[model samples]
Target: MSRFLPLTIRFADGGSMVVSSIADAKKALNGVWKDKEAPDYLAATRLVDDAVAGTCRPAVAFAAFKKAAAQQGLLKPADPSPALTMLDDLWSRKGKGPPG
Candidate 1:
């Protein structure tokens, strides 16, 4: 009955997890984060709990969770879209000489 979307948490060790609920987010936050003193981290903990109880918006918790992850360097940059990748490839070959 959680209203939150799944959130991807990328660890510094190159591992990752998808959290579907505030409970899962809390587990990921604890297991993956080391900066307990970070402002966002603290806020996420509170918001996540409140979200699960329907006392706050799930989006609020989601945003806080993501911010906390980012602050702790536990969030990975999203992969570039295929269209963007294609544009980069086309640009690279536009004026470059082939076979030196």
Candidate 2:
């Protein structure tokens, strides 16, 4: 098998896609300059590379991927994380009673 594995992301609509490498991710970011003039581009590339290399958290890289995909109109708005949703629910009821 090829040593390089593609990074995959699944959407709530049952749709999914893969990014094969830093170059692929950069291509998805339309209008991104391919040189040092674009620090965001470089940073994102490094993040994806590190994640694929197992040096960074997959969640972190996936978050970056999601942002790029959304910008490219390939992804829908992301729902809040379960933990954040639970926290919001708790705060909304803080002045009332314990959660039942």
Candidate 3:
């Protein structure tokens, strides 16, 4: 399957992993995760599996996997993209009249 936007997960032992596809998420959920029955974990498992089997969009599965990682305290916040940061700077200065 095609790749989704990458999601980084931080391990308690200070290692980090990036998951960018439904297959990667499936492997992480089924092989690496210890708690097999958490609600978010189950949901992500189903979504990722479904994505692999062509039952849902890869984006939906990837998003679910990211949410599960966040719920489990394994999600790593992405670094701000330079282009997005510049846009944010411009937006923050909005409604402030012309530049001096």
Candidate 4:
């Protein structure tokens, strides 16, 4: 009933980071915060906002997400897409395949 998420983090100051999900990492890096110091999420959100505003580069924000994923040690390795399951079922054709 539970799922595991892979994530990572990267820091500009060479610090460490942690997160639970890709969305969580993104939010941690980029979401707003009341504290001016800006936690990882807030900082990331700011970077993404600047990129969206055309004030910063897209790579900057993208790297932030990657870094966050790394720091959290949650990055998932390359795996086949879930859609492959459907393809397998279709190919097997227990009922849907061409009639003999």
Which candidate should be chosen as best, given lDDT against the real structure? 3
Q: List residue ranges in candidate 2 displaced over 4 A.
A: 1-42, 76-100
RMSD of model 3 against the true structure: 4.2
Ranking by lDDT: 3, 1, 2, 4
Residue 48 in model 4: lDDT = 64
In terms of lDDT, model 3 sits at 0.79
Ranking by TM-score: 3, 1, 4, 2
lDDT: worst 10-residue window of model 3: 91-100
CA-lDDT, candidates in order: 0.79, 0.55, 0.79, 0.52
TM-score of each: 0.66, 0.36, 0.70, 0.38
Q: What is the number of residue pairs that collide in model 4?
A: 23
CA deviation > 4 Å runs, candidate 4: 1-38, 79-100
**Residue-level lDDT tens digits of model 4 in 1-100:** 2122433333444553445443444455543223335365456667767766788766676566555444444444545667987776787877666445
RMSD (Cα, Å) of candidate 2?
8.9
Q: List where candidate 1 sits over 4 angstroms from the true fold.
A: 1-7, 12-14, 82-100
